[model samples]
Target: MTIAEHRTDTTHPLDPMTTAEVDAVREVLTRDGLLGEHVRFAYLGLREPGKRAVETFTGRADLDRRFLAILLDLGTGASRSVIVSTTRNTIDSTVDIDPATEGQPPIIDTEFELIEDILNADERWTAALAKRGLDPATVRAVPLSAGHYDEPGESGKRIVRSLGFQQFHEKDLPWAHPVDGLVAYVDLTGRRVTRIIDHHEYPVPQEQGNFDDPAFTGPARTTLKPIEISQPEGPSFTVEGSVVRWENWRLRLGFNEREGLTLHQLSFHDRPLLYRASIAEMVVPYADPSPVRFWQNYFDCGEYMFARYANSLELGCDCLGEIHYLDATVADDLGQPRTIRNAICMHEEDYGVLWKHTDLFSGTRETRRQRRLVISFFTTIGNYDYGFYWYLYLDGTIQLETKATGVTFTSAYPGADGAGFDYATEVAPGLGAPLHQHLFCARLDMTVDGDRNAVDEVEPERVPVGPGNPHGNAFRSRRIRLTSESVAGRLADNRAGRTWHILNPDKHNRFGQPVSYVLSPEGQPPLLADESSSIHARATFATKHLWVTRYAEEERYPAGDLVNQNPGGAGLPAWIAADRDIDGEDIVLWHSFGLTHVPRPEDWPVMPVDRAGFTLRPFGFFDRNPTLDVPSGGNGGHCAD
Candidate 1:
């Protein structure tokens, strides 16, 4: 029972659960009387195999295939974490969750409608809307995660705070007309409204936010010509099931209901670099301190299950050129199998140049174009659409770019004469878009050459003119070994050019330097919420730019497992309290990077893509430029005036 039973059908140990497997899981739980009438699946996915199992796997039938499922009893406000063995047809274990202490499970899809039904039928909710001169039917209520504040009657309940937005027509953009100053707290287990908080009302903005409508966008511009990209010889990449190989890079793709796209067993030229990499968690915190919005914070991945909303990609729009798509399957609230088709898009893109030089003495020029394998997926969470892109370059460089787009989350402005609130921007006449921060944490389980690795905090500093150099222009790099978990928490200093190097102390390049890959940060502000705020305690992982901890199988998420109703001080902040030694041991790097968006006028209607991310480039991993052997070639699309 210690080893998860293997299946002959699975190709890899890390492959996600298939539709058939999810069905089997549901059947097993039902047969064991673990599933009740009101019990719903909150989370379900393959339990990852241990590191030894992953490394020693040989495409054989002997693999771990256990499944982890979180079930919530909406009728009783009870939650349980269950492990099921579909192969053995038995329940492995079940742990009950105390919401008042341990927190509740993630909010499921069925609960969304339940919240609306509870609010729509309540007289208090309708009367509040009538007070604002709005009809009940015209309001679209969106259930939001009720953050913990230890309030009376809400301290240990499964509650969802809902906001209303007026929609004149079925197709009307509801976000444009926010029913401000009114909030409803619905207890899902009780199937009733616990309370409604109504403050001073604000006028709903009447401007249309339907940018895609023909009337709003007007005529299309015909001046720009089309530029087509095609690969006549097909792409240089090959995909066999979940494993993908392109040039010197090879990796396996994994998708689950929580984390959308994950990369495992990533290697360059048959040498292991990363064991696993994924966006572990993301938080969206609004800065508005208004009574209704003061508690606005969202754990997109942990609370709402971010990957469940992954968009089915389309050609020439979501992807271009020679493309390959992969489908992801997950269980729904009823523990029924559901498949998202074309959820992953993989392709190759031509970058400007890998290397270029002109030898003046010989009057000769040399250039090698750069190309990268792109693995990406997009998820639309509420009013925001996020595209997560992972690029593996021929030059041994890895970069993750996150594109945030979609309509801005709006609030009705309180003032007249076009003035906006201090915490918000007047995107429209009476529409205010609150300032917010999108903080993302990426988990990098490093296996530089092997598993044993260490990190060094490197910063470029200018030398004093009096001591190290006569001139003031001298500069040097300062490297400090991050040997323990306590001191490894760090901040990114853009002025000093900070980066962290994950290196193998036992392995060295030809130059006798430790083989390593450096994480180059884009350097943005960390969590801006005050330390006293509840969100700051809950999302403590976002408070630091970098965190290095010894590898542990259970430390998959930066936020704790049950993040929906979690109070505070869990996940990264809790794990590091042990202050374990990390030097020359298997380590994982959690880098937090993102954007603090202050919405502009152009961001209204629909927003263009805003990108933020970090890069992992070879430092001393290679003796010299690894792409020197990249053949010189061009498409020969020269133009004449």
Candidate 2:
């Protein structure tokens, strides 16, 4: 299949901006005199239509086409949020943003190159590199987010902390060698180095970290036979533009600069399950408390905009078996549309069994095989490659699985045995991989049956020996309705098998219970950072496993809109202060889940894939088994295998 290009026709309100639409956005901004040398496009994406607009959409030609363009004034350390209407060729509104108070906007791709240029041009930075017995040309200095620390001179500036690693040669991985104890804070607005802090020097690791090449492994293994997956009649799903339908499942896919992929109007059997869903934000906070690496927490989705770096997937590599690919269009720093071919992969997989039963009395048996429609995309941010996958099963189960794989971020070890460092593990001979947590927050805007929904925190509790439970082995699940936003934030208890249900207050199943879908969490610990730490406040959303709030259009991002260098208490922590009523009203659910990584020796060179996610299962949404109608059969050729 050939890759798709710009779309001239807009079919749905939730459809992503086409390449032509992106060009029109730039034209409107340029006509309004918003384009200039000092001004740079930090982020550009389709401004999501309001809930009513989407619900009322009927493929109307008069649908509003709006684009959100975040522009940064590099000269003044300020930004502007411009909403451009492509239909009218005009700017609908513009909001002036002051970095001093409103926090810095996301850094553009050009700024990464500028950071390297600024560091190489600086005399002090080169001298520090020379003092470490390293040449400037053999080192690759990169920019990292300068987290909010309330330090002396970093209060109101657009700053990026710089760290360099020894390159040695062109093919050598820079992460294998660390030029420790040296840091430079660069003010991008001023286009200069603000300060260079160099503590005691440490020797850079000398081991090579390349393991993918043929020269590194010597010979390839030939013992494994080829395992091919083929569907003779092609995939089971159908796609019309961004909308996908398979079995009884249907949803529209969305992609943008921030959130890589989003699903809208998720339904099973034409019953609304989730109105919108996406991985809203994620933070990777290092546990090292060293002076040079203390403020090392990174908001990969919010701060760095990792979605902009999405990998162009290929068949038989990222996906297999009658795959369908959807290309995504995003804006560059110059406000030009850039197309990522095969950005989204869609296919189906056969799970073992959906339902099975055997009647020994009658000597009869019945079984049904299971299948799921998979929609996924991968993005590589720096040294980490992450794949976000959404699965829709035949039995009304939805799951989001995150795959993390790539080279581990390394540091220099102090001792030969790699002791005394409490927060890091030696992944290589002298390379220390710091302990870090990849905390991800997913936003679920649900419409169980209609909009009048409520959330109930359910926990299975143990029963005591009494008149009701004299056997001393009885237990029952308890449900608590979360009425308001203040008490909606909750932590997961694995011991109690805690789960949450989003149900429609007006609808019920055949059993007279509220029609609902339950969210099953992995129950991983929330942010491990202390309350007194700066990251604790900035990443307050990750402090709780679940948060429920009344749905508001502006309340989309969990970590606030601007997450570059902003202080704490802006996104989830700031919004719940309203304490709005959430029960029996339109509400949104935010679930945080992730992995805490302490690297091992086998994780060096290139780390294997690690998975983390949550699932949603129908609780009382249906009266009987939904997949009872699924076809029961097996591949005829499987007997020979």
Candidate 3:
């Protein structure tokens, strides 16, 4: 049949089919019956007899056209069927097939009408979609490990307790306490807690006085024989009260709080005498104008004065140790005559208690009196490890004396009026400062108990010269004096006496070139009117042993021989080398001694105590090894020498 005729028959009023139904049926018949092609079909709609009919037709149709049919039926009896033909190329697959019943009219093409109806419908479908979106079935959950819940508390506390802890408390612990995670306790007694167990890598107990222990206690005591001397034959002197004088001999008194008393003098003695005459005088002021106190004061003051004078001379370096030859004949480890000026010595001294005063008054008129104690001592300096030996005597009246042996280099200024100046300022051009000078002689004399004449009558005894004594050096016997009229004359003759010349033709001077000559003169000599014949005199001879030459190459030289032959050139003892380099650079070493009683609270503004003499000597005088680059040991290693 023609398509228009088929549409009319199917769409007839009595046929119970609408216009859409007729159109759908006609299209399906044309595409499947008129043409051969494969197609699939299904049915979807509301539950009812109308839906059932549509599904049946869709399944039973084995035609080439695919019919996806949908049925809509309200429970109110009115129903519709839509047959969609897949063979048709249209925007929608729906074709309504419902007929009018009662007051409702048939829907012809309901596709657009159904869409509008859905837009006007209530929000049930939208709400249903939202509910489905939120359902738990949309996402999967991950399971946690079983080990996480195994413990009841924090992990750190469990570890600490696992180690070796019993009971613990968080209170009364330092902010940086070892066991910040856990605080362990030990024992307690009153305000003082006994102990605590720290959870640190290396735990230690906290206590007072754990590391402090005395290494020594009190003052060490020792003794030496009193030094006495016989008088010279020229003049005889006697002590009148505290004054002693004869010809050029003179004596005086001096005082110190620590040493209590002292006696000083200018005296003469024969060369055979082995001991020097040093007398002490003291005057102990009276608590009640007592004579005994007066004499005691004189004795104490005299002793202190004498000791100080002696100590000053004892610790000096005499120029009898070592001398270096800088000539071309010498070769060093670097195969060159070493060109460097350097000197060193290690010496020691002993200080002894002259007297000690344990009872002195303190406090003002309005305050209670306090007792103060005072101590005085004598000291001497000499070589070898820079010795310092001391003795203590505390029974009001005590005597002490010290003797030392070592080299003493005499400065150009050796008399009472002598003074030192900068080498550059004191020396003339074309001549260098003196090195390797020998100290020939040093002397001091004093009186005790206000005995001035005693110094003149008492002669200094000549001490026995030993094998290593400075006085025994052959070159140390020369003596030179500086005088105005003969200044130039003394300078020329003293060149060999006071100067060191560089003889190596290839050796570099301090300015870095070959050195031709060098010299150093003693200071200006005293005028005749200013000279004191009996005063203390220290004479130094310019010796050849103390000179060192700087070279441009590295070579080993006979250093031992150069030092051995020069006066004052003996190297310091081995033990002194422990903390110093004796072969390196030029340096000067100095040391001094002093005495004071044990401290007491009453002595708030402490009085100056008696200070002994001092001396300086070259210790380590050079740069360390220059050829090697040594690495430092982080924080722990032997300290630099």
Candidate 4:
């Protein structure tokens, strides 16, 4: 079974075992007669045995003792407990599980593959189809999604699936339309559908034949010349193992079960800048306010687990240019090795002009070639896809961006009575749905030169003139040092210059300013969920635009570990409630970025990639221009001088 631990925890014991090691443990467990009827592996990985004096896994690596920890969900009426096998000595300890332990049912552990398989196999499905009077050939029941019931008083591990019908249309384009609010609730373990929440929906209500309608398909006569980005000199980067070394960037790439692609031990010009950085968590809660859509709030990175949904990546579709790939090992729902090929594609792109200067007097112009290293990947969820991109520039800056694409989640419409037009637009004749928001939080563990770092904000305010300024147009800089995590939560203000930064107090550039990275938010949306909603409780990280907290190993996720069934998020908000002294400690920067999309007709078929995110540019991290040495030659053109 594969094991994974999030963040930079050196003492974490969870290590994924290979197929051979899994076989060895299976043989030992089966031999011991502990393999009950349900013999399903919930989780298997390594665990750090005891407390340690030094938490860092440095030169003392040899002291690590690997013990296999397996979580098994056996037959009915069986209690679940972890089995620890010291792989070093199989005979010494066959199963050292505490008998007092009973299996704690996971919030929701129903895998997508298993849910799809079981629903397709159940006989009740065929009967349900007959009741709907739908032919199996033209109309097929599709599994939309499945989730756990996490309300209070809800006990035991139970999961329910949502199924919708779509008429098979030869429209050629992506014609996925949900059959109006018709949902099914299935008792997964019981192997029977207890009830169907069909609203007696009809084909007229759904735009089945409209999938091929020309109104939805706008006339296309667009043609353009190909603008290709090619690497004539091959790649300007090198990858040895998981470590990448580019022009001035050096980072160890990692992919985990939680955060898909992460950069660890990131350095620029052989100097440590960040210890670890990744997307902490994300939530996409719709604002339909209806019983169906209102309760459909989703904590994607936390609940659905984006890392597990990472695509293997296609050659031309995903990335281009002298591209290099990184492989990641993931655990399947059955706890087997699932290799994610090219989980991260790294390459350089021409981001237009890097810099240009002209001495008009002499008709001389100087220009530096522009190129950026784009380390990126895409993760798909339901009908939408998210592209996570990290662009590294030669000017000592890191631009983080997330691109959202793929088909919009279209809802059925019985002809809009002019109600949802405020919230949604009818891309087709009868498909109408409200617009939604996608909130993403990036947990940047800022290791600026060292662990002990300071967090602050710089805002520009117009001078309210008296004697200081006769004209009210002059502006002043308002700087504040965030002494505690409580005061760190804030919103981005473009007018007031609401920008936050993490700085190394001890490290200063030649200008004597503290070396820091300035966080600039881009395209952030306000939280629309009510304060009383459990989604709000679980997603307090999205309430504010920015949060700075002291680094804690247990505080890796902004949303807690049990995101699938978690109502009240258990990580950042709770940690911030501690009100720790964050003046000069290892700081973690949490930036929330999102898009407030109101459906437009152009959003039909597939939504164009709408990008949102922020950039972490070097403030005083470097003295003067880091790209000062850039070659000042024109692109074979005459100088502007």
> Which stretches of model 1 miss by more than 4 angstroms?
1-8, 634-641
What's the TM-score of every candidate structure?
A: 0.97, 0.97, 0.14, 0.83
Candidate 1 — what's its lDDT?
0.89
- Encode model 2's per-residue lDDT on 537-576: one tens digit a residue: 8899999999998989989889899998888788898889
lDDT of 1 by residue, 1-641 (tens): 13333334567778778877887788888877888899999999999978887878876567557899999887888889999876676789999988877777888888887766789899999998888889888889989998888678987888888999889897789998998889988888899998888986888789888777789789888898887989998899998888899989999999998989999999999989999999999999999898788888999999999899999999999999889999999889999989999999999999987788899899867777889899999999999999999999998999999999998888877766654478888888788899999999999999999999999999988788886687789888999999999999999999888899999999999889999999999889999999998999899999999999998888988988888879988789988999999999999999999999999989998899999999999898998888877776634332222
For each candidate in turn, give its C-alpha RMSD to the true structure in angstroms.
2.6, 3.0, 52.7, 5.5
Give per-residue CA lDDT, model 3, range 260-335, as digits (tens): 1233332222111101222111111111111111111111211111122223212123211121111001111111
Off by over 4 Å in 4: 1-132, 135-153, 169-175, 192-195, 199-228, 360-364, 415-423, 633-641
Clashing residue pairs, backbone N/CA/C < 3 A, model 1 = none
Instruction: Give candidate 3 misplaced runs (Cα > 4 Å).
Output: 1-241, 244-250, 256-265, 269-480, 484-641
- Which tens-of-lDDT digit does each residue in 299-380 have in candidate 4? 6665555666688887777987678887666554455556778878888887767788789799867678767889988888
